[model samples]
Target: MALTNPAFSTNPAFKENGQAQTAATLSAENLQQMYEAPSATSVQTDRMTVEDTIVKTAICFAFLLAGAVVGWIVPALALPAALVGFVLALVNIFKKKPSAPLILAYSAVQGVFVGGISFVFEAQWQSIVIQAVIGTLAVVGVTLALFASGKIRASKKATKIFLIAMFGYLAYSLVNVILMWTGVTGGTFGLSSDVRIFGIPLGVVIGIVVVLLGAYSLVLDFDAIKQGVANRAPRIYGWSGAFGIMVTVIWLYLEILRLLAIARD
Candidate 1:
């Protein structure tokens, strides 16, 4: 139930041959024309399709799956793979121009990281890995359904709340890690075990909330893709879309894994 990698904007008509564009070069009249939408601003991207996202995501996942197999066979690559993936993730994020090869390679490295981690966790919890996988699929499926039915959407208010929640969660995670590292807590799972609300672990609650956030992220991704199409953005933004989906899926899987671990514990 992973989200498909998003496709690039299909607006080849407005492209500047993969080169960057700016107002300093375009004439006043050209700029004026560029500002105007080809049709009504309110027009929806009904014509655009989500199929490409699926295809591209499948490709990324294929590479990931392949990397996982390799990871299981060669445990030594796990640490290096994770480090490489982290660096690649940063590089991809800061790069103004999307490089397809580099992005795909990043996916491969991430595959090894994910596979190795999953292997370790699954070994510890036995069937819990399966449970987490099912949970991830269920969450992703339900979110997509809600979105397709127009029951869920990304609004400014929700986005604002999401940002605040993410920041708070990050801060809490940092504090929790510090607590664990400083030997202030004797819990096995850090804040996940030490902090419980009404007998329920904090991590479980946080996981559910974060799952919703990831789903909303999908909505935002959709909105961005639609806007890109309308804006006649360059084709490479497809890589951007793919990268975005990868990020969301990774986050979702990690959250699911944590939730399952807490449940098993």
Candidate 2:
């Protein structure tokens, strides 16, 4: 499911007249020369670019990894980290402007949740964390390559389907959590485990579908980034793109981890 970050589209920099208008009297030759000028680096102009977005994403991941290491060493912090991360995520998502500190903070806290939960799952599954990590990376790598190659693109119809599926998944997840908490379901995965289709756990199917949804979400992220860069959005918005990507990747990893665990069981 795609977590829409308003910072990408709601910002004024992307709107008409947000940027300075070019001089109308400028000659065609002058305009051509200006267009041919060296591409603006992040430091050169406050405009967005693919490179800046990459750096922002790398920074977020670095903070995430650092926090993950701390969380892995102290597994008891998982739930608390998750709660805090959730609140921070909401704040970042709803904030009018993208704040680097808040985005980084969210990444760090989410890392703690990821690491602690991974450790807990690894303790029982023996190497499942590594598997999930590799799986997540593989999926991301392939999706990126496909997108960069222009072999895949997001379409309005597909996005509509994706949103519908995401809503259905959210509903299912809510009910499953309720069942688990109320002691109505007798398995670790609640309805996902209790229900079977063709002798396979329902989670396996749901997990695969969720993973596909996550993949499409990545495509949307890429599309958003492309639009941002093309529109010469403010560099600060790159952090918003990075934040969206990190959230999607984390969701992808968790879903893959759960799917693997269910399969192993």
Cα RMSDs of all predictions?
8.9, 3.0
lDDT of 2 by residue, 9-33 (tens): 6666787574675768789999999
What's the TM-score of each model vs. the native?
0.78, 0.90
**lDDT, each prediction:** 0.74, 0.91
Candidate 2: segments with Cα more than 4 A from true spot: 1-5, 16-38
Cα misplacement distance, residue 22 of candidate 1 (Å): 29
Error of 1 at 31 (Å): 31
On TM-score, the candidate that comes out on top is 2
Off by over 4 Å in 1: 1-49
**Tens-digit lDDT string for candidate 1 (118-137):** 88887888976677778777
How big is the RMSD of model 1?
8.9
